[model samples]
Target: MYSRSFNIKKDLAMRNEFAKKALDANPSHPQTNYDYGLALCNEKKFDEALIYINKAIDMDPANKDRFEGFLPLLFMAMRDTENSLKWLLKMSERDSHSRYLGWLSCVYAHIDDLDKASDYLKRFLDERPEIKTLSDYRKVAPAIAKNL
Candidate 1:
């Protein structure tokens, strides 16, 4: 986990260096665009982040995880329910067994859809029943912080 965080940090730094070079030469490169968007997402600059994320997606939507993860979460953080739900459905279809169900629990909670939240919460808990209360949830759950 430490290595993954280190790599994310390292990747961000390397990408920033590369971004400077790209900016000096031409900012139109797809990788530069994507990396800039990824960096912006890491920085929590969602609106600016989305511009480049969409640019990268338009250039090549084949890497669906980029759009689905980075873009949708940006919208979610911004409280843009429309786009968030749209991507949530798409992501759920792509990988229902994934940890994203934990996110779904939060979304449903946010919308005051406790019933659905409870359903997904049950699934999430059932997936790893060891997590029962908020205290235990802090540790027993996966490394990624997602609502259950």
Candidate 2:
């Protein structure tokens, strides 16, 4: 509720406060940990967010796909392309959705591996040709918007 409300109102401070309180009450709770981690990430505290998010994934391995999706984005936000690629590769091993392929293309582009980038991009386009506009590309893969 707090997270949703924060998203609606764009209230960072309030969201951070609520997330912190939730974490304080149940430090090991997966959802709370993930929420707090998300809030920290919004604050650009990537390292701190990574700690909580990793804990959340560890506490609830069954929901690893959810948590793992964030890992690559976090690394990308930190401009750590190598780490981003590493997490993206891990995610691809577990899931092969078209969205993942699009991200893989972006990450490959970031590393100047245009061959791999073009390959993944081609696959992604073949899978999701509806994605056309710059806005659409930005919405789906902001990291690769330039490449698109």
> What TM-score should be assigned to candidate 1?
0.72
Question: Under the 3 Å rule for N, CA and C atoms, how many clashes does model 2 have?
Answer: 0
The root-mean-square deviation over C-alpha atoms between each candidate and the true structure, in angstroms, is 4.5, 2.9
* Per-model lDDT: 0.66, 0.83
Write the residue-wise lDDT of candidate 1 on 12-89 in tens digits.
Answer: 565555554664465765556766665565456768877876777777778747554655566776678778767877
Off by over 4 Å in 1: 1-26, 135-148
Name the top lDDT candidate: 2
Model 2 residue 124 CA deviation (Å) reads 1.0
- Model 2 spans with C-alpha error above 4 angstroms: 142-148
